[model samples]
Target: MKKILLSSLLLLVCHIHYAQVISIIGSTSPAGNWSTDIDMATTDNITYTLTNVNLTTATDPGTTGLKFRQDHDWAVNWGSANFPMGTAVQNGANIMTQAGTYDITFNRSNGTYTFIPAAQPRVGIWGPAVDSQNGFGGPDVDMTTTDGILYTLSGFYFSSGSAYFRVNDNSTLTYGSVSFPTGTAVEQGPSIQVAGGEWFVTFNRSTGAYSFTYPSIGILGDATSVGWLNDDIDLITTDGFEYTLNDLVLTDGEVKFRKDNLWTTNWGSLGFPQATGIQDGPNIPVTAGTYDVVFQKSTGHYLFTNTLSNPEYSVANVKIHPNPSNAIWNLKHDTTIDAVTLFDASGKIIGNYAPNTTEFQLDGSNLSNGVYFIKINSGRDFSVQKIIRN
Candidate 1:
């Protein structure tokens, strides 16, 4: 009975010493030396939590490593030394973190960690004349990093050269590497090489991983002939990625650009957005008119220029009559007429009359019974009228 009681007491003491206690050690200054223990909760047997931890600092952009451990012991820690954010934790690995205030929770039983960032990450891209393709002097193009650790710059084009990921918009503080796989570490290195073409680029500063891929781009919306069809009218490729569509008629509606004619990959904007690199933004409104549209695939910028309107038809000034005239018709006008030309429905000139007078006669004895277009020139402007014959 005494031996059994002693064994039971030892088991109870072991459970109390090994359960409900956790802490973290990392690359941030607040994490203190890995040697010291930042004790967490003792009440929960399966989970541990920490709050209001600030990971932002000057060195924060490069990397922020973290790992949850039992008490102050490294042998019982969890993480993959270079693991990216949102990944499941692994024993003996280091968790990669971004610069932001966050509430971090770890599940000891499942080897998974949850990070709730308090703020967004700052991201942008820059390079020399060869890589940016915007001459040597430039303000770098910005990027979106909503997932905190992954930064993406879409519709990017560059020549065969190199560039770096700018840190906090500061050119001096930047990171770079070669063509790398997703989820690799982003260390301080030389510029990355690129080919000339349009691309969607993604970079993870925490893991130094980067990648790029080609994209299909075109315009779509209600203003076009296809009327909001995802793959209606496509822009003509000027270069490998830049596009232009000449003489397009648009109605009073909205428009957007999509990849391969799908809503899954699309872009739009508020107002008559132009000249700047846009994102997956809002819809752009337009009116009924003919235009020439230009889209820069490398930058996601678009421009629409209205074409010249058709010449007006002065029905009040000119008159052509004789009721299906099989003989001849009189063309009368009040203005000083310079010339009059008759054209068939196919736009082929049937006859040219230099009737430099206000009144002229149109002979239809040798013409077919059909519709024709009569053009009149006066002063610096021109007008058109439709004439019928029997």
Candidate 2:
């Protein structure tokens, strides 16, 4: 009877501890008032996450307060006057939160917490061309998108096979793939079949509009003539390497150089008149003028000479054969290379080199299957290219 009584008490104590749900409450909430709670989820008792929660001052302005409470009760709670991350204190000051959707993480063990700006929800591809049928074989190849709805993968060399998109990979949120690249992308929808050889791939998440365009690097965004459509004003080339778009007009807007008019392979972030375009950088800003634009495909050196409103965005495509090679990838440019840095999808540096040579080779076999970016520097010129491994 004593053993039975002890077991009962132990079960009761365990149940109470396990049932202690942590919640985010106080002035900011999707519920519009401090009267409600946004419960956080946890797989382990130590760390809790409240995902896709909107903490706004829009509805209740000036009340940008936030806190984490146990079981939606005030008795057990934590707060701190911190923007992103800090150690929590019981009955502490409200966190001054910015108005945005966030993935809030709290470590119950150490009272440490963070409000990380949520990554945009996105989708990616799995195919024979990318990861050797890596759907069941390996991780899907992630796509790039300025607008979260339209995902793109460019300059993808194919061996006459097909692919599918699995709406989630590294993001905290999950979604479904579009089959045809046109129409509404429904959850549990049939997998997409995209096929070709060396093509630019684009898939729309909201509307299942997908396309494969023969690769060509050109200017895109609202600042250009076409205004953000796929109909990019193609850059001209004489030697098939250095590209030029002479006598072009731009405006006081934003623009980026892209391949096949998609964000799949693009360059921006270098400043006006002349600058080295970073791969997948932010949109280049144009104050206003018409100009002569120059782009070195091998080096990513871009120059905009203005006579009218603004300068210009220009680009050229660098082809990859047998996708570089089996074990090593070579970067060959006309100018002297000072340094090289390779980054993974998470913006984490995986490889760094100081070759200082026009011709440089790096091992590709060591990289895991996924998307990677290689940045090269030559004098003031630089180039960033997306490298893929299956």
Candidate 3:
């Protein structure tokens, strides 16, 4: 009896430690704008559009107020027919003040889609097909297979012209294996038809670039005839084979691609590498070592770091004080005490101090208005916090 009891207790402890609580709280005006607060296990997909945001608690899993514009015309001003329009910035909270209809979407471990809108739109936000209780922005696609399995894809397509695909029951949509004509751009559409058994889709043999319609699986022609080369480029596989731009490159090394105005790299099978470089347009050659690399176009900077080994330090905490500090600015920690080090986001350490000091007051009068990080080290434990010095 004691053995069974102890085993049960251990199981209970594990369950409690792994359990996550995600809650969304806020006030939305009937006009389609809102301010909200969210507290969750992780901010994996939490997004908001607003101008000002605030956090009221100091707990690791505390709550934050997200602000955004909820007016319907805001989207029009930005040339978007959508009701909400505005920019979103996430600090401890998110803020957006554009005067249009807008919806904030978030995803966490429990699956995706927790929409926060100022007011319900006429068409309403689409919910997930699997879990109707949760909502997602834009249309949702459901592909059923003969094995009684379902697949769904979300997000808008960013391409020139759109392409379409179909599937039938028992038949699965095999990406990469299917070939698309050169310059063919595929965009995800609102929906696609898959027969009950099995089916396949083919793109037109046209040589021009194509892209998908927003929220729909349907393809559309480019509004302007700017040609195909600049839209989608051809790719050469490591197997010494050439694949169309439509073929999804799946390999152990790095995969590079250009999106909008930026060049991006995904470490592929190399997992995380010590470094990665773009050999060609979208081809990334990773170092034999492993390290995750992230690139920012606006700043023209590449950030390389190790993947998460400890969940506690995976994401850095961020705090900002907009008001000018008369004396000093306080930097606080929410976890076990560790050595605190400050940097100017340029990877240069500005100051370092012992931990458990409750607060580290910095002489902000000499600092400029910009972003910085306060890195905390506890034994092998490491975490970073963002601080904006006004």
TM-score of model 3 relative to the true fold? 0.23
Please give the RMSD to the true structure for each candidate, in Å. 19.2, 14.7, 29.9
**Cα lDDT, all candidates:** 0.64, 0.68, 0.33
| Candidate order (TM-score) | 2, 1, 3
TM of each candidate vs. truth: 0.30, 0.36, 0.23
Each candidate's number of clashing pairs is 12, 13, 50
Model 2 alpha-carbon drift over 4 Å, by segment? 1-85, 89-124, 131-139, 142-160, 166-303, 307-390
Across 248-303, the per-residue lDDT of candidate 1 in tens digits comes to 88888988877655566676777562433356777788778888776654345566
Question: How does model 2 fare in lDDT?
Answer: 0.68
Q: Name the better of 1 and 3 by TM-score.
A: 1
TM-score of 2: 0.36
How big is the positional error of residue 239 in model 1, measured in Å on the Cα after superposition?
11
lDDT of 3 by residue, 188-259 (tens): 333222211111212231221322211211101121122222233323221111111222222234334333
CA displacement after TM-score superposition, residue 324 of candidate 1 (Å): 59
What is candidate 2's lDDT per residue for 1-390, written digit by digit as tens? Answer: 999999999998897677668888877667756778878888777799987676654322235588888877789888888777899999887787766678889998889998887786657766564666553466677888644666777665554444556676632233334443333444555544544345567777776667665556688678777887446888876433346787788878988887665565788884876676888888888867777777755445677766554312212222233453556777776666788888764446788999888777778887777666677766654555667777
Best by lDDT: 2
